[model samples]
Target: MTTHYNVQKHNTIYQVKDRILIGTMPPKAQVIEEAPDYLGNILKYFSKPRTLEDSFKFITSNSSLSEIEARNLVEELIENKIISNKKFDSDNRYSRHSLYFDLIDTPINAQEILANKTVGLVGMGGIGTNIAMNLAGAGIGKLIFSDGDTIELSNLTRQFLYHEEHVNNFKVEQAAKQLALINSEIELVPILESISDVEIFDKYFNECDIIILSADSPAEIHEWINSAAMKHGFAYSNAGYIDSFGAIGPMVIPGKTACYECYKNDGDLYKFLDNGQELPSNLNESFQAPSYGPLNSMVAAVQANEVIRYLIGVERKTEGTRLLINSQNYKIYEEVFTKNENCKKCGHFTHHTENLHASFQESSLTDVYVNERENDSFNSILLDSMMDRLIKVLPNTKILDIGCATGEQAIHFAQKGATIIANDISEEMLEVVNNKVNTLELKGIKTLHGDIVNLNIEDKFNYVICNNVLDYIEDIGTRLSKFKGLLTENGTLIVTIPHPIKDGGVWKKEYYNGRWNYEDFSLQNYFAEGKITKSRENKDGETVISSIESYHRTTETYFQTFVQAGFKVVGLFEPQPPNIVAETHPILFEKCSHIPYFQTFVLKKE
Candidate 1:
């Protein structure tokens, strides 16, 4: 028996002037124009599911084309998906969905894929109810939704899932009832409890493929949902409104795109509103933003469309971006974000450590570093402060210098009759230290090469100097504890790092009222700990540029880590370049004077 073929359902063919057109409606529509006359007859005969031999016979009888020409046209149509050999059941409820899937370029049917996915919705309010109805209409297999609020007369303005009779009933229960009427084949699980904690997500939505958060209450609910989504390793999306703007977006896939915290770290609203301080007691009262039925439905349509597109294995527009739609002017704006390597929630700390080790190992970097340390006025001022502290304990004290590049501090300590152990990650840098020790005949100076965190040394020292090293180290508390253990009972640890304000801040130019103005330097995501990458030219004026990576941490975090590690802060200093730099390098002097360039902490083991 021969197989039969038919033109796909919902396709239309017509003649425009001397040309014929075959087309279908979008979401992945196929269109063919300027067809020969014989091909039109072939399509007409194939509309009723006829075998290839019958189509060829009918085309030849109706038109002047040869049998071979008709056969080739039918074969090409099947290849292009304008016609299908697979039979579709037209009597089923999802017949139109199957026909829609026929236009897509996937190996499997999309409607079938939708039937296998389980979606969990967090709220049953205006946006949530609309999304639920849309997903149910699209034949989503199972929906697990929760809401604690009871429907009131005000809710009926935007929430379509409830009616006048459902005025006093719980939203989840009424939503499930209305959704069941739309599609009896779908599975609906409704919970009448408000989501207040992150643990509730794992309890209910553990098995869901995707969880969408539409609740706008508690203000911190998005963070809780993000934590749960990241912990469970599931895809999630956020959708809601703020004032007249409806926001949908940032469909997050675990390990693939940026999470909610990454967006929060870079979002504009977060930059101004999140200052790590509690608001006044009266200011903490709950307030609701404006909401309308049309706006809710519009946002819900896009959100639901994104979920469907993701389920069916298509490219989603909201991945790693937030889409804000303005209702007044119908303008759309987008905010794009990426996975932050320093994001406290979804960032990886090991990659930054690995990059730091690889970067300092290069000889070019060490050469430039040594040259800068010798000539940089900023370094001269930092060394002055360091020497002032070390001079009091020299001439018989044991000093352990972590990250002692080129043995600058170790050689000075050894020359003053102090025993020294210089530790560094790069062997090339340690070789330079050894070369200086051999040339100067510096006694009591030993070089140890490896990451300081992993190296084991039994000898205790009176002073441990960690110069510009904490910025590269991720686990500060653990490293501080180890440093405390490596010191004598009354030992002191000296740490120097680039000031967080100068390292993490950015200067942006704004144009307002028809003029451009340079704003004061503002710290971007100052409280969010993450890896920062900076690029600079080498001192030799070479065309090649070197990139440096370091972690940004606030002053409070460093102080807290020191206190937790049983250390007392003896001194905290923000050093400025010496006065001579103003006459020598005026540009560098201006910046160093205006901004706190380096932060030094003198901590004592208690």
Candidate 2:
């Protein structure tokens, strides 16, 4: 189809399939000289962005332009901004961007489809490779794949991206090459390392719009990602396949969703069954690993589908929690759970380190690329145990987490089988949480912009937990009362506060980051209500200074305030970081408490 256009004095007509007369561009305007001569051809092909490659192939096959000439024309037009080269920064191997089935072909809206999104895959093994392919074919704008391992011959059966020639190449890089071949429009970034590595995590976690956790990492990694995602406020998704039958889906939606910990504790009914004990059944023989095709493909497709729904804003009733696809039982199951009110990282004590690579501070790269969500390793065992205990008690319950920075607790709760609403005053924090929530393909989780003093939830929840928040507000009573309207009839409110009388008031010192240097406290001023200044005389400026200038209240004061608020204290728990004693017989400075030192008040509304 030859599309001809004549530049006139009053109107400029653009011929694309049908003549598109853009009345806005004045007729006498100078044409962008760099626009491709075959723009009509490109536009005809771009009627559907997915068929871009096929259009190019068709045009080159018939026209006098060589393949290289056709590519140059497309590039020139894109560079001139006359047309979008959706495939500009990509490499296509299997299909072109203009070739995917439109939303009309499925029960989806094409307009709702996100053609410009970047998603990160943490591993490029059987599962990660499959996930990358599915997302790429779906028209996601950019694909980032991470894997430290090199492609091995054994990985050939399931990891299709690696050919015999790619035997020793980094799995992620090889996968990127293959993925690019499939859809050049999809930008591929290869990270050759584990997601848990500080360098890799910091580089990709916040940059990518979404992340999929598919590596067989340690249990700590699951919590780390949960906390990091919540802290960074990114959307994260995790899917697992076992015995070719059991599948688990956990998604964290920032502040307004259940988190990974929530699902780990609540959704997996058979979770922690042995509790470090011997295996109960001889299913070890029957539980042999299953075939990779069905498990990998089905799970990856589900993950991709969920990503699409999140991008389109097609709200789901089940926003946060775990979906159990049990082909073994021939029954699909789902569970709603709540947050561990005492979660160290997501709870009152501020488990978030804010600086992970402390030891590496001397390294110039450390300052440039270190994870901010580093937590103190001293309390890992206690916090881990406490999280288990808390989840075991609540099992699964609807929860509202107040002052939820980055919705990490919400993500944990959602993962544990709870419906969660993660709320915070900072929009930046909420944004990060929402990104991870969308990535996870979770249900029953939501994020809201709100202050603890004025919560705006219409529905009441079985539990409302506020961690490390009460101490920051001056009007504790008034701020807490707002929760009354949001709690269920018999709901419990779990509050964590630093015991006012503990260890000679508040201690302030510049501790080393998990790496070697100090923290970047610059962006915090906009979020926190107080300013942290360096006092030359005082040293370290009293870290944890009250956000609102208020007198610290002792345990008695807290109890009195609750009575007036019409809440009865059911449980008073304290958390103590390892090696730091709550007190050494009240007078000495050596002994930490055997019990958790920070107080967790579990209260019930009258």
Q: Give per-model CA RMSD.
A: 20.6, 25.2
In candidate 2, residue 431 scores what lDDT? 77
On TM-score, the leading prediction is 1
Assess each prediction's global lDDT (C-alpha) against the native.
0.78, 0.58
Q: Give the alpha carbon lDDT tens digit for every residue of 467-510 in model 1.
A: 88999877788888889999999888888888998888854533
Residue 420, model 2: Cα distance from true site in angstroms: 50
For residue 122, give model 1's deviation from the true position in Å: 0.5
What is candidate 2's lDDT per residue for 1-606, written digit by digit as tens? 333212221223465443443324333223433444555555555544433466568668757788888777666645533444233213534223222322112223432255667777777777778778878777777777777898878778777767899998888777777887887876778876676544456667676666887875644677677777777777777766655553434566766565765445443334445552422544566544554665666666667677666655654323464444555443444544444555544442221112211112122211111122213221232333454465433555888888666566677779888888888877777777788889997796898896856554678888887866786676778866887767889887888764454312322223221111122212222223322222111111212222223335567778989889989988887755444322212211121242223577888888
The superposed Cα distance between candidate 1 and the true structure at residue 419, in angstroms, equals: 77
TM-score of each: 0.56, 0.38
lDDT of 2: 0.58
Candidate 2 regions with alpha-carbon error over 4 angstroms: 1-113, 246-248, 269-271, 274-291, 316-318, 327-331, 338-606
